[model samples]
Target: MRSFVVSVVSISLVASAVFAHSGVKNEDVMKRMKQMSEMASNMKVLGAMMKQQQPFDLPLAKAAISKIGELSAETGKSFATKAEDPKSEAKPIIWDEFDEFTKLADALTKDALQLQSSLKGPEDLRNVMATLGGACKQCHSKYRE
Candidate 1:
């Protein structure tokens, strides 16, 4: 678990450095970008564990799921006002179809919460990914660039 946390922190640091050059000027947009980056890093960790590239630690897996759920809950609020930035991947249609966008965010939160509870072993993580990942892809395909 300690190593997992360290890995996530390292990824976040690197992502932050990269995002610094993404040219996002709006503070809110930058914050959103960072949030999304963090989610991606958590997903990467989950993927590594699922693939057996990294040893699966239950605590770390739970922690990652928890962070994703927390972030998913906030996703709607983050995009509530249609803040714009040059490097943001969010599509303008998000604001145009705000309800649908938020609904997808809500679905992600629900899926994550459900996944967190159902995980019993490494194999469970693989199953969880299919459902959780599908929710993410469903939203990103329509709402993100």
Candidate 2:
């Protein structure tokens, strides 16, 4: 399980590197990528706090989770259109499997909200990381390049 999480993070880094050089020029895809990037940034904050790499900040983590949920709600709107630029990490499968893609986004929103409410501190937050990470990996593996 731990190895799997590392692999997911590895793939994300590799994909980001590949896209950075891919010369993506589409504004729409860029918007979608930005949304995902923001979520990733928030996740890092939460991970740092939960893992004890940083001091726990409950209000800050909750705020980040709320932002993640907000971005998640806009996910379907962002990716529903087809405008793949060279720099896009999104796959064609997103449009082909639109329903499933939206479902995954909805699931993430739900997870974020639930985690926000249920997590009281670092220990509770740590326990929810697997479920949170798994939700992200599911969409990423299927929809992202």
Candidate 3:
């Protein structure tokens, strides 16, 4: 399990390094990416705990989920301006259907809150992560490039 966690984090780090070199020039786009990256980092920690790679710490789980909730709430505001960058993964349809895009982000925040409130152990974490991940996938499929 520990080896699996290390492999996952290693892959994420390598991918992040590659993306970092992709010449993302727009400040707003960079901010958006940074926010998303932070959320992903927190999720990775929770995921390791959920998978039993690491011992579950309720306080740490709460902190990570709380941060995700805060970031999810800010998603709409981050993308509200329709900033562009060659490296941006956001699709043009986001601005075209801003309401729908933001609705998804809002739903993510709600999911995070639900997760935070209901999280008691690894089992609950697993369920909540699935819901949160589904929310993310739904938005990405529609609004991300």
Which of 1 and 2 is the better model by lDDT? 1
My TM-score estimates for the predictions, one after another, are 0.87, 0.82, 0.86
lDDT at residue 130 of model 1 (Cα atoms): 83
How does candidate 2 score on lDDT? 0.82
Residue 30's lDDT within candidate 1 is 82
Cα RMSD for candidates in order:
2.7, 7.1, 3.3
lDDT of each: 0.84, 0.82, 0.84
Per-residue C-alpha lDDT of model 1 across residues 1-145, encoded as one tens digit per residue: 8678767867777777575647778989988877877787788779888998788889889889889999989998888878987777888989888999889889889888888887889988777778878888999898888
Considering summed lDDT, which 10 consecutive residues are worst modelled in model 1? 15-24
Q: What residue pairs clash in candidate 1, if any at all?
A: none
Q: Which candidate is the best by TM-score?
A: 1
Better of 1 and 2 by TM-score: 1
Q: Write the per-residue lDDT of candidate 2 for residues 1-145, one digit (tens) a residue.
A: 7558656865786578456645657889878877887788678878877777667888988988888899999999998788888777788988988999999999999988988898787788766677778888999998888
18-102, model 3: which lDDT tens digit per residue? Answer: 5774788899998888888877777877888888877888988988888888998999999989899988899998999899988
- Deviation (Å) of 53 in candidate 2: 1.9
The whole-model C-alpha lDDT of candidate 3 against the native structure comes to 0.84
Candidate 2's TM-score: 0.82
